[model samples]
Structures are given as structure tokens and as C-alpha cells.
Target: MVKIKANYVLAALWITLLCSCQKRSPEIPEIRQVDVLIVGGGASGTMAAIQAARMGSSVLVAEETPWLGGMLTAAGVSAIDGNYKLQSGLWEEFRKNLYNHYGGPEGVKTGWVSNVLFEPEVGDSILKYMAGLEDGIELMLNSTLGHIEKTQKGWIADIAYQTDTIRVETQVVIDGTELGDVAALVGIPYEIGMDSRHLSNEKIAPETANDIVQDLTYVAILKDYGKGTDMTITKPEGYDPSPFYCTCAGRCNQDSIGRKLWDCEHMMGYGRLPGDKYMINWPIFGNDFYLNVIEMAPHERKQAYEQAKWYTMCYVYYLQDALGFRHLGIADDVFPTADGLPFIPYHRESRRIDGIVRFDLNDLARPFAQTNALYRTGVAVGDYPVDHHHAAYPQSEALPDLHFYPVPSYALPLGTLIPKSVSNFIVAEKSISVTNLVNGTTRLQPVCLLIGQAAGALAALAVDEGVSPADVPVRKVQQALLDSKAYILPYLDVSPTSSSFSAIQKTGATGILRGEGKNIGWENQTLFYPDSLVSKSALQTGLQDIAAGLVITSKKETLTVNEALKVIYDLMKLRPGDTHFSSREAMDEKAKEIWKNHMDTLMDPEVSITRAMFSVLLGELIDPFSNWPVDHHGTYRSGIN
Candidate 1:
């Protein structure tokens, strides 16, 4: 009878296979091209779309997930751990929207860097709002890229989603995907393992080399009500067979009780919830996915997630099931994924481009003024210490909370983002050009956004100009970013000034332009440093200071006496123009003659400024043409992206 049943089972299996083979072909959607195509809709992709849209380019952002904001919203991780220099453009606008809607930073007087605590939904609302605020930005969610091919036109992205198969054409593409999938698809050369050596040379890395990277965390935000409920999760299948927790006393930094408190007992994470007391996205529970999370078969993927889920569920069960802890519950409902895990894996590494330029710790430690190309391309500012983390390393042990040299202002290179062969595609996550080990330094969210802003602005400009991203002039892009108020360069200009003064003096004082006097390094509490490059906005204040001083009596120029007299007469009669002489066309001929006369007539020999006398001389030189390109006062204006 058993043998007969086996024969029947084989017959049934063959019939199932036969039926599956008879399935019809799916109706694929027609392909469409775009000026700019972004692969992911995370923080970087969202910002890129904003840039392209503002530049008046038709752009499409494709995301596999349901929402936007990669680590910020999707991953349910809080706190933008990064340099303080993150505020401008889409980034600034994002913050403003958050502040306006949530009243977080908007209520504060100064919000250069406010640690605004909020739920993931807020981030979701804000990103969606930004995408809507701009035109020409199409966000295609649930879209998956099947394959990418480069043709004579540019590149073609073959995508499949839900019940449709479509193709997208674009001049430029951005690989904002979390895993660097676009780079891999486009054949970008990149490194995967940790550097056998330190970031630069053999300075600080471990002697031996390894390929396995740092651990990933599945984060979620849970609230408590101070009263126990049925919010506990049960142990997953194959829980006991898992070897993914910190086991060694040395590694875990726990004797026995600590381990029991977290592992065996699990009574640690419960906080005053319901009352909204604490937010949990801690490192208390770590899953062992590297050892067990692989998908050899379609069904295995579910098994993998189940294991991870069990790890998390068992974590809470240790609190509720084993410890009978009160007021403790899992917030898994807040971020449930298709596999019932957190929306994101908190990945530490994906794909790093091996393109034009590669950044290493050596670049940071490369002794300033000792490098080129890389040093010249700084678009943002950062001073955070190099931070790296891995699971195999004893993360549970009492760490020194190590910190390395503080990098002031350094340029993040273009090569790091662009793939070697793909001209249009760029990356702006922790998965840029770096050995997996170096990702430790670049993974910080703020740094990621800094990279994102630059990539976004560049892609936007490329879309607007109908050119390859490689062809866009970096300087013009820099200027546009500067105009948008994004922090693209070093923060060397921050002082008082006004449009009524020449930007030359204000900027010269701050530092960018070379000056006659030495860089006295501003120890004098009374004197404004002449070498410092003051912000363009400050020029207005500087002009006001100058206008207030009595030095306005002006016996200025030591030019040809007759020329000076003519200049004085012209100045007395010429109050009717911008830039001192109509900067518009039709008046170009007149402007040219006036410019020549002005240059020849007023060659002031000596320019002087006191904390007091400084203002008057500045004003006299400014108000003449303060509304020009550099502003009437000439102080360099700046904003952040």
C-alpha cells in the first residue's frame, strides 16, 4: 500500500510540473527613457530626484520598497550620527518640512544641528511631500530592475514590477540602491573585502586580513505603556540550533548574569511605553545572519527570515516568556516587511565603486597639502573620527569608544561615486569607493547625505544640460550648489559684512583670497582678521559698519589728480544704476566706458580698517555697486544642501 502511495505522489508531482510549464508569458510594459534615472528611493535617491527636478529635468526614481528614506525611515533608525555640517538644498528643505510639520527644529531659535527625535512616519511624510513639491520627479515604487544594458543613446534600464515589464531610457543613472546593485549590473570595478592594511599604509588595521564584514542590525521603534499586554513574540523555528549570539565571556563582556539578563532571561529592553517614555533601536539583540542567512533556493529565503525573526522574537520572549517581565513588548508591527522582519537590514557594506577615484583612511591621514585631485574636490565639511564596527570583533566587550584623528575639511572625490565604465551612474551611500573596512568611516548617515547632496546636484545639472554627468562643469555645479546654499567647500568664511562693501575686502579678510598681510591667526580680540573669507551675507553688515564711520568724508584716490576729479564728478552725478554702471545689455556699451573710467579714476592707494574705521572705508567702496554678482558689499554668501 505504501509503495502504491509513492507512485501516486510521483504522478501528482509530474502533473504539477506540467501545469507550471504551460503558464503564458507575462505582458511586458513598453520602455520609456528619462533625462535622469535614479535606482533607489532612499535618502540619496530622493535628494537626487529633487536636484534633477529643480534643474528642470524629467527624472524617474525607481524603488523596490514601499517607502522612501533608506536608513532614516525605512530602517527605523533614529539619530543622524554625523558631522554638524548637514543643512542645505533638499537636505535643508527636508529639515524645514520636518520642522514646519512636526514643530521640532522650527520652534528653536538656532537649528544648525538639532537632534530631533521622531517616528518613522514623519520621515515618510516629509520625503513624499518633497517629491510632490517639485515637478518632473516621478517616483515609481515596487519597481525592480531586471537588467541594465548600455547602448549608443546612453543606458537602458530593464525593469519588472507587479504585473508589468518596462524599459527606461536615460542619459544618466544614479545607483542609490543600498547594495550597489546598479554598479554590479553595470560592471563597475570595486573591492569587497577589508583592506589587508589600514586605510593608509599599515597604520591602524589588524595585521591579518578577513573578508567577512561587520554585523547588520534589524532595527525597530517600539513604545511602552508601563502595563503588560500580549505584544510579546514567540520563539522562531530552529531557535536552539542558532549559534548567532555573543557566547564568550571575553567577547560578550558578561560573566553569567548579564548573559542571562539578555539571552536566557531577556528582561532588559522594556521601558515606560504607552506613556511614550523610551525609544528602542539599541544593539542589545544581534542576529547571526552571516553564518546562516543565505538563499540557495526560493524557499530558503523564508527560512532565513524566519531565523532572524526567531532571533528577534526569542529576544523578546526572553523578556516576556522566560522572565515574565511587565511593560515589555516588541514593536515589530511598526516595521513589518514581506518576510516579517524590519524594513531594512542596517547594512554596513554593499558595493564600492572602483572608478576614477578611491578614498581611503590614508586620504584622511594623507597629511594635508600632500595630495591632489582628491584634496581639491571637497564639497562638504566633516571632523568626525574614523568609526568602524564588525560583529566578529567583540562588540559586546567594554569598548574604549575609540576615536581617531579629527578630519577638518576634506574633498570627497568624484571617482568614489561614479562607476569606472558607466559615465552617468553614481553612488552616494556607505557603499562608495572604499574597502569594506573603510566603510566604517564613511557609513555615518550624515556623511552619506553629504555624498548624496553632491551626487544629487550633479545629476540634476546633468539632466538639465542634456549632458553626461562627467561632462558637467564641476565649478558651475559648485557655484550652483553654493547658490542653493549647500555647504560644498570648507567653512573658512564666517564673519560680519554687508552689500554696501566690496566682497574683496570681506572675502579677503576671511581667508580664501591671498592678502598682503600674513595670516595672523586672529588672536587679537579687537581686530577683524583681514585674511579670513567672510560670508557674502556678512558683507551687508560690514558695509553698514563702514557707512556708520566718519571716514566717509573720502579724500581717497592717489590716482591722476584730473582723473580723480573726473571720478568724483561722475560719482556725484551717477546714482542711477546697478553695479555702479547698468549691468544690463543695451547699456553694455555705456557700462564698458563707465567701467574703464571708474577703474582709471579711483585707484585708491591705501585701504585701511579698524574694528571702527573698518566700516566707513568698507561702505564707501561698497554701496556703489552692491547688487552685482558678488553682492554690492562683496562678502561671499553661503548656504547648505
Candidate 2:
């Protein structure tokens, strides 16, 4: 009996040991389910996270760096580029915040290069504050992408932190990375460096594809030396000081204009930040690393990154050593890095995805009348010139043909964000499907933010509808963007001086044009009477002119609420029994009968109407799905699409 008891104890101890060993081994990664997973925490990533969270989705944002704003903050390029006057949506919100933070709008306009400029830290704080407003968004800072696998249900990404890994399963994934890393990892086809002219059909594209890409820069934020401070930086390993003194902006560069070295401006520019500091992103005779990091291997990329930093350091050293700017040192308090440089290089080129629509220079050069469909299909708007940086590089004879000018403010289509072969995925940042020439403009901070917001909205809508993001209709996406107050159309520039400017502004939100009145019956008299009290027939005709499809006409003094409801009912084809009017449903009640009676009372043609009432009615007629009864829910504008 004793021996048997001992044997049982020994067996129990062995079992306990085996269990301990199993527990010590690695366990399955924690599976976290989310509606959207946004990779890259730059300008687009932050915007995407906020937009998706606002749309009632659980979003997980994994950023490789600690900062949220990529190019705007972490990359040290704080000077906002493009979309200065056409700001709306989150872009407008951010700019407003910046303006308020610095006392007013003039605070941000401290530099000549851009309309808005601030310290990188200011942008970082604002983005963090914005991210905090969304409870559904989980921002994972200092997290890197370990691995990713696509499943039929969605995508699974392994997010590795210090000593643990979290597996994120999301229905939609947005590749907002600066380099399109996620797209490449997921086997999506993309183009690196410059594309051939024959393929992109960009007038500026090269005849053959080349490995040469735009130069990458390590932007420097320098404070004025007159602030009673003295500093010095260590000289870079490569001490070559010859190329740093040349005139590269074509103003004095003899290679272009046959001028002496002293003819060009210095390789520096005014900073947009406070305290009159200077932002040194100068590509002329400065640190523009000519290597193509996107096409490089792991080892090669690291080498290039290190060399770029060294070049920037060399430039800084020259400022103090050669140029006699002893007080102008690196802003130690700005960047968190030990060397006072940005966490990442300013990558001007990335592996652009082969999206459903590849926007080129033609998209920017052509007028909206010639491409109305394309204009109406735009999801974002910008008017930046096609400014290419390769022109400043060595052996860049092709640069002359590559640069373009007078690029008008144009809209970017939803198709530009959708990958041709991939579902449940979208791209933001420079990785968007734009030709190498067009990328110069589309890659701007404001445009990338718009793209990010659009991608986020599409992802959230897809998750809500249980459909792929690519399946969501473009017009529906446009509607959501419009509701978000994004400026989607740039063609109808309404001047405040016009009597119909306010009406045009409102109606243009729905893609309507303020029509020009024509002479009727050969009387040579136009009926567009601005500042006159509008009649019922005139209002209806104006609606029709704006293409609202309302045909009811009357010469009555006042338009009744019933007439508006009837027009809406006719245009939307909403029967008496739709969910839109389900609020009237009760126990044993005829909801359709109630709706018909209610609409009849609301549609009485004799009720007097005001201009504000007309505007509200027009808003409802254009978008029947909107919750129209709420106070101030009506969109102000001419009804148009």
C-alpha cells in the first residue's frame, strides 16, 4: 500500500513538471479583431484613424515611430505644402487648431514657402489631441510590422512590441506607410522609381523606366542665432566641402543658365515655425541624397539612410564652419533623437500601387469641362504645381523635361485609392496610384490627409455594409466626404463679390453649377433676378437649372411646405411606406396612411416660403437619405450633383 502511494505521488509530480514546461513555451498571439487596421502613423495614418473612428469602427493604428504626423512632424517637414485656400474637413480642422494655438492665422504664415508653418512638436501635439477624441481608435506607438497574412475574412497582421506580439484581424487595411511597405509585403504589384512615359503617358515621364528617383532629404529646423545661444556640431565622416558651395537652383548654376557660382541664392529658406526660425529643406546645393531607398535591399537601405544623415550633418557643419553662422545650430528641443534629426528621411518616392485609376499630369493639366466625369469623380482637391526634385540632382538632364508648371487645382478620384487587384485595402501618402510626375503634387501633406480620410470612410462603410471597400459606390463616398465638410470640387470658384456667391457656395457642395440665365422668347431679357423676392415658378425653374430634376412650376406668392415634400417624394420616389418615415409607426397603426397625410399637410402649395426654406428644401431633395428634420441639418446650397 505504501509503495503504491509513493508511485502515485511520483506520477503527479511528473505531470506537474510537464505542465510547467508547456506553459513556459510561447503561447498563441492574442487575436484582436478590428474593423480597420491602419499601418503608418504619418499624416494620412492619423487622419485615417480619426475618420474611421468617427464612423463607429474599432480601429487599430500601428506606427513604426513614436510620432503620429509623418512628414509634417516626425520627418521634420513642418511647412505645410499645397491646398492652402481649399482647406476643408479634417485638414481645415487641423489648420484651425494651429491658427488658434499660435494666436491667429498670421502665426502659421511665418515663412514664404508655405501658407502654414509651425514647429514639428506643435503638429505632433495637435494630432495626438485629435486622436484622443476618438475612443474607438487604439494608437500603438513605437510598434513595427512583424508579419502580415491576408485571409478571406480579412487581414491578419502580427504587431510586435517589446517582448510580446499582438495579432490584429481587421476587415479593411489601409497602407498609409511612407514607402508602401504593407502593399509590398502583401504581394501587391507596384512600381518603384520612375515609370516609363509609354506606360504612364505623362508628358514629363522618361522614354524608358529608370532606377533614378527624386532625392531624399533630412530636413533641418534651425533657430535664429541672435537668441543669445552658441552651439557647434560634429563634422561628418565624409569631409568633402566642394559640392556644398555650388549654385544648384539654375539661378546661378552655369550648367543651366551659364552663371557664376556666386549668382544663385544661398541653400537656405525661411522657416514657418514661431520665433522666426528657419526650415532647411533646401534641395539646392544642400543635402539631397540621390540614392533610391525604395529599390534598395535591407543592407543597402541602411547604408543609404546612414549616408543621408551624414550628408545633412555635413550641411549643418558647413553652415557654422564655412558660412559663419555660429549661432544657428540644430534645434535640440525639437526632435527627440540624440542627433537632433528626424526619425525618418523625407521619402519623395514610393512603390505606387497599381490602382483602378492612375492619375497623371493630364488629370491636372486638363480643364474640368473637358473631363467633367473625372472632376465629379474626385475625392480630394489640390492645386500645387508639379514640382519635381530630381532636377537638382547630378546628371539630371532629363529634369528639364520632367518639371511642369501651371498645374490647376484638380480633384483626385476614388479610383486612385482603390487597388486594381486587391480588395479590402487602400493606399494613402505617396504610395497612392499617381504617375511619378503627378506624385509631386498629390504627395503633398493636405492631399495625403484627404486621401487618408477618404480611405478611412470607405473602410468603415465597407465594414458597416459587410462588403469590400472597392464595392462601395464612389458617389456614396463623395456624399460621406461632403457630409464631413471636405471640399471635393474646385471648379466652381464662387467669388464673394457676386450676389449669388452664398447660394453658389452652398449648392456647389453638391456639385451644382450656378447657371447663367439665357434670353427667353428672343426678348433678350434674362430672368435671373438677383436680390429680388423669388416666386414659386422661378424657384422651381432655378432648381431645374441646377439639374435637381424638379418640374413643378407655379406663379404663387409663397411656396408651401407641401409642395416641397411632394417634389422630394417625386424625386426620391419615396412611397408612403418607407423606413424613412417609420417613426410614425405605432401599435395597430397604418404608418403609410399617416405618412401620406403628414406629407400632404407638409406639402400644402399655398404656404409662404423663404429663401432659407428653399435652400433647406433643395438640400433635402438632393440627398433624401439624410436625416433632414433635425435643426440645421439642411445643407445650404443650390441642389446639384
Candidate 3:
């Protein structure tokens, strides 16, 4: 045999490997099916899964990371933003549970940046525990979406779990990922970076679309080192010292509004958390990544993430060696990484979908409630200011035009969650269709959580109704959310803690919703008596307290259905000879005309009324707005305006 030269042998091996790669077969993905499939396990994804599971649907939650909380835990942005007192539904439950965990609400206010604060690990554990209690939810950590295809049965998504691949079929799919990855992978039309001023009609938007987005930060947790401690951080390779612009205490040192004095400060910013730990998320001096992570290849994205961590490491080095804060060090137990840093970046923007309804600056300007029909369908509420973080990065020339302003407490419409062309899909969190200016406030943690909860509820309702998410009636979704004890309107004083809150919330448009209950003489004190079985006598008394004309002198224990109908007819001044009455055998043309113009229904003669019926009847009679009450056989039907 003739021996080949070393170079020739190496070249032959490389050619063989290339040919073998081209001939290899693609791997097959395993299949699994569920009623609802959620692609992210961040703040919104967790809430989406919980709500869907709560609605008797089998939910599959696939998270890329092991921990649950997104910005709050893995990203280490533990400071909760906006809607502190307006917490409703699952959010209220979360706050209550957090309070109980910390022993009281006072204990949760451990930091100055937010009214409520807790350790990142504490929040992560709480979310995990809550998900664990739901039997319908199957959570798969360390899994990521690979490829998604739409099907007649809804949709199927290929998920990658390290070396293994699984295909998931779902009736409803919610895109709650931090960066809107599901929407992008499924071919949904979406926008990345800043939108145009004319397109979104937002005053703060630029004239044209810019690839610049809000800067992301690799937040760090610093523990108090004893006095005179001398720990030093090594300088990271390829670090840019010119970008660092902040002193340690940026919060108190800088101006509160408009452009800040400097990017960094010398004092601890945003105050501290419990256990003597300080959160270092100051935008001025902190390590903020100005590059766009969306639409990046895997290797490019990984390199960007590494750059962010390296920048933060450089900042830590500055804090300890340069700033003379030798006493401060990275929290040893906060994160599992080698240097004890957070696992991910706190992302501020995502690939926003082209939704059925687009929220703009005008929607957040307070007058859109009456002018826009979609605005009336308020599903989530937020009150955060429009915050943009572009001044810190010099390379992001287009981002400096963004400015902050106070946004009114506004409701997000259900249309924002529904995509324009996609079926059986919903996008929550920062992915919802809104202008860049509106996203400033809507991207807050509280609003995102509510959106996630509503998305889940909407998905569950769609699955149950055998309809697409877009086909579900807005009012029905609102009613389902209301029934779930969600606070649609923030004007109400009573929360879910009130016994009759759900009933009162549902009847708000009918002008029958009341605050504290009126005192009935029989009761020990004034109360709604929501749970007590109501009798006819009690309803008559309630009617007297509400309607001035529907007074009944004879108080019977339980009046027959006929008596109730007769009482309502008498109050409306209708007589038996009227065409509405079955006794009108020889009604004249004029009498028939009167009955035709004012249609009403009559109830059964002998059945007793329930408490719900009594409340409805009482509400119709005492119309504060002086609107006509449509009578469906004396069944308290609300009249059309």
C-alpha cells in the first residue's frame, strides 16, 4: 500500500466530514398535546399558566431558565413597578401572600425604590410554589421553543430540551416570552426597536423607525462588606471605561425629573433591600447594554450577553477599587453564577405584535376613554411614567430623543392582546401592540402580570367556547375576568375583599353599583348581606331603600313570583287592561300601541326570589342616571341607552 502525505491525509478527512454532514438525517421531535401552551415562565408566563390552569384547562409551560420570575428573580430587578394599591385577581393574591411571607406589608417595603420589595430568591420560590399548587399546570424548566407551525387544530410548537426535542400541540397559545420569541418564530407580523412618530401618533416618537431600543441592564446585588474590607474585582478584558458616567449615589445626587445630572452617582441608588443587600440598577452609572438582542443569531446573542456581564463586572471593579467602596461586595448567596451575578438581563422591549387594537400616546392621555370604543374594554390598568433609557449610550444616536412624562392611570384594551392575523394566539407582557411611548408605562411589572392573567383567561374561554381568541366577545371576556375577581376599573374603593364586590363591579354600567351596604332595620349593623338567603320581605325593604315608588306596605315572609311581577307593574303604572297583560282580550289600537312601544316581560306567579334576583330588581328601580329600565317580564333587564 502507498502511504499518503500528512497534508493530503488531513484534507481527505475534512472532505469526508463535510460530505457526511450533508447526508445526515434531521432529528425527529417527540409530540405532546395540551389545551394551552405558554412559551415563557417569566412574570407574565407564570400568571398565564396559573390562570389557565385555574380555569380547568391543561396547561403546558416551557421556560428556558430554571427559575420562574423573570425580571423579579432571574433578571434581578426585584423592584416592583406601578399598580401597588390597584392589585387585583392573582396579583392581589401574590401581594397578600408576600405580605404573609414577610409577616406584614411593612416588611415588604424594605427598599425605597418600590413600595413593595423582597429578595429575588423569595419571589422566585413564591412563584414556583404557587405553580406547584395547580394540578392542571405542567411546568418544564430548561426548555426552549425551536420551531412553531400553525395547524387547523390550533398550533404545534417544537420545543428543545438540551439534546432532546419535543413537539407540543395546543388549542390556545400565549406568547408571554420576555422578547416575544414565539411571535417571531411563528411568522406573526411584528415590529422591533422604536416606532415612527406618524405611524404610532405618539408625541414622543421619532419621525422614522430607529433600530434603537431601551437599554438593558445586567443588575447586580451588593452586600455590605464590613468597614475597611479590601476585596478587589479584576478588570474585565475589552472593557470601555469611557461609557461609565455615574457616581455611586445617583438617586439623591441627581435631579428627580428630566435628564439626570450624570449617569452615575457615588451613593447607593434606589435604596436597599432586606438583609443589608443593595440593588445596583442605576441607569446613569450602571452597566447598561445598548445593543439590540432581537433577531440576533445564537452565537451573536451569547456574545452580547457576555459583553453585558463583563461590563457589569467592570462596574463592580470600579465600585470596589476605584470608588473606594471596598466594603461592598457581590452578594454571595443571591445568584448561583461563579461571581454571584443574575442569570439574565432585565429586558425593556420586545418584538411587539401588530395587534387588532393598537395603543398609542392618545390612549394614555385620558380623553380616549370616551372617544375610542376599544378603550372602553379596559382589561389592565397601569400608572407608571414614560421612562426611556437612551442617554447613557453614545452610539444609540436615535434613542436620545425619548423623554419622560407622567402618564394617566389608563386601561389597556383587550384588542391589544389579539393579533391581527394569527388565530388562537395572544401576546402579553411587552409584546402587546402599543406604540413605543405607550410601552413606556405598559411594560411595567404590574401591568404585565395583569395582561398575563387576562390572556390566560381569554385563552381558556376560547378553548371552552370552541372559538379562536379573536372571535371571543370582548364583553364575555370582560365578564369572565370580572367573575374571576379582576379589577377592570380602578375607580372603585372596594377590592375583592368586600363580600359583594363582584356583583357591584358587574352592575357598574347599570347604575346600581353601591359602596357600603345600607342598614336594614332587622340587621344588627349595615351590611350587603351577600351570603344570606334573601326573602321577599327583605327585598321589599331593600326596594324601599332604593326605589321611592316601589313601596310595599304588607311585608310577607316570601312573596310569590306573581306578587313580585304585580308590584313592579304597579310601580310602572301599568294596568291589567294594558296589552302586556294576558287579560287584555279586547285591547284597543291605542292600548296595543302603548304596549308595543314599551315592551316588558312578566315573571311566574308562585316562585320565590333569590338574593341575586332581589339585588337586580332593586338596582333597576333606583336608577341614578334616570335611564329607562327594560322589563323582561319583570326580570330587571337593563335598558339600552
Q: Indicate the worst ten consecutive residues by lDDT in candidate 3.
A: 517-526
Model 1 lDDT tens row, 98-174: 55654446332221122544456556656766676666877676668887888776788876655666678888888
Residues 393-439, model 3: lDDT tens digits: 66655453554565556667788898988899999889998887788
Q: Model 2, 489: alpha-carbon shift in Å?
A: 1.1
Q: Between the candidate structures 1 and 3, which one is better when assessed by lDDT?
A: 3
**RMSD in Å for all candidates:** 13.5, 13.0, 14.0
lDDT (C-alpha, whole model) for all candidates: 0.51, 0.67, 0.67
Off by over 4 Å in 3: 1-29, 238-242, 248-266, 269-271, 367-370, 395-403, 507-641
Clashes of each: 48, 11, 17
How accurate locally is residue 412 in candidate 2, as Cα lDDT from 0 to 100?
78
Give the per-residue lDDT of model 2 (tens digit) for 362-444: 75566232333344456777666666777446788645454435465677777788788888898888898878888877888
For all predicted structures, in order, the TM-scores are: 0.67, 0.75, 0.74
Candidate 1 C-alpha error for residue 168, in Å: 0.6
